[model samples]
Target: MKGRVIVLDHIAGREAAALLVDGKLTDLLVDDDSAPRPGAIFRAVCDRPIKGMGGMMLRLPDGETAFLRQGKGLALGQSMLVQVTGYADDGKAVPVTDRVLFKSRYAIVTPGKPGINISRAIRDDDVRDRLLACAHEAGVAEGFGLIIRSSAAEAADEDIIEDIAAMDALATAIMADADGAPEALTEGDGPHVLAWRDWVEPAKVVTDAGGFEDMDVLGQMVSLGQPRVGLDGPAFMYVEPTRALVAVDVNTGGDTSPASTLKANLAACRALPRALRLRGLGGQVVIDMAPMSKAHRREIEGALRSAFKTDTVDTALVGWTPLGHYELQRKRERLPLPAEVMEALA
Candidate 1:
């Protein structure tokens, strides 16, 4: 399946969610609670770039070392555990990465993502409630928030109940099993992945066309109402990340517009910023707009800027050198999406 990647951040506590599909990353949704909390570890008011003081480690509310460095980006009303992705020659904060050690401080919850975070300060009632908590979407009751994942959307309450039961038992059984492991817990596809897959896949794969059908047989489309669907295809892929480097190669193909190579190529140019956004490509992005005309150059430049509006992270076209290449500087956030996202339309 051409799976997408999403990193769920700041849920319940300073925790990050690893949303991977078939392994390629398609999205990164960092969960930051939009609510106000008392004595929150990372207060939202500290809206400044990390000072990267000798790559200091932050002590989390749960007492984990949230790492941080100098020059990390900070959002308004957001908190984080950070460490410098870069360090000075003397081992101080480097203006570079500003890597965050911990996850987002915004441990807020909502619908659309299914999850259950048992507090470290587990209460007997909380444990019992988790143990006896009806996974049934309809009957779920407790002080703790219950995320009903997308996979469970059409699932019978009984099935979810059993899932909850199994999950609780597994958590219970694993406590003894986690004898020496420092990193707490184990996992499977949490509800967020299931919901997202359910939501985005169908609309992307509406193939009523010939034999290349989306035949899960059970591969049914949402007949009534709900969210969208995502397709499971080979076009998607995930790649190992390395220090800031990116290359985009436009392969002439079915959509390459033979009518006018310039226009087709222009589409590709217009696509750079978006392609970058969807895939979260960072570090210097070197773009080759497939060699075109002088006037075409101006048009391509304009298109590149227009597409850049979609970027959540800051970026700039540092102008092309005499080599006819453009430069794009992207932020280094969590795991980036794979470069393969553009090939899906292929």
Candidate 2:
């Protein structure tokens, strides 16, 4: 409870992983079998261009259509490789990208981008040099780029080199299959794999059966179903999701001091990222912060920025709206918690 713990288990027959820090559920990954997962590579055929949207539709071998924005100059019936970027909304085509990447725990292989780069977080000169050496030793193919992830800083030299080699080989194999008909080249990493890949920090790993129950992960997950998230300063926030956007309402529970509004707003900013992450909520987010003076807007903005800086999801803080609401645009990287998952936990 005082440190980090990773719980790998099955929920409702789906593979799942949960990260707990200081006894609190910090992050979660659950498999969604219904849709093509993000990071899945496919050789798709160009269908038709939607000039009005500045994008094109693609036809996959499974008879599903994907939307690729900024896909210009793709002639009809032409075969090209694409990667699923995120899940689609109801009745919408899955979003795909032309820029496909092969990612692993220690290295990421970029096909078109040719260069060897180190993570900026690894500031030690010796570490950076050693990581660069590892990348060079792995031997990146021509027209491909290698990125040494920050996790490689503490990893063994051989392990880093091996990871790089594996990713490079995978990218080569996938690219070579682009000449064929539209079909899925490779599926994305599942929950357990993603947990190991992304949650690289020091933590106790639990893989035994009933580990979720033993670690109280199921109890914590139950709370995620509710919209209420308690914050510091005795504040609270309701993170409700609707069809259009996620609406967050912050309130100062029992604090009536003159600084209550600002305190509650800042607390909401700090707790928001985790709440959204656990809920698997994304897309448009409108935060109706507790009533505060306009002078404190910059401070709230700074708090929001600091809060989401470490979050893994792609989020854009769009600043305050005219109606005193703060807006955020988040990428739908994770699917919403399905009903079956909650039932299984229960």
Query: lDDT scores for all predictions?
Result: 0.38, 0.93
Question: Which 10-residue span in candidate 2 carries the lowest summed lDDT?
Answer: 337-346
> What does candidate 2 score on TM?
0.98
Q: Can you write out model 1's per-residue Cα lDDT over 93-120, one digit (the tens) per residue?
A: 2222222111111122222234554334
Per-model TM-score on C-alpha atoms: 0.36, 0.98
State the lDDT of candidate 2 residue by residue for 200-256, as single tens digits: 999999999988889999998998888999989589999999999999999999999
In candidate 1, clashing pairs total 27
Q: Which candidate is the best by TM-score?
A: 2
Q: For model 2, what is the C-alpha lDDT against the true structure?
A: 0.93
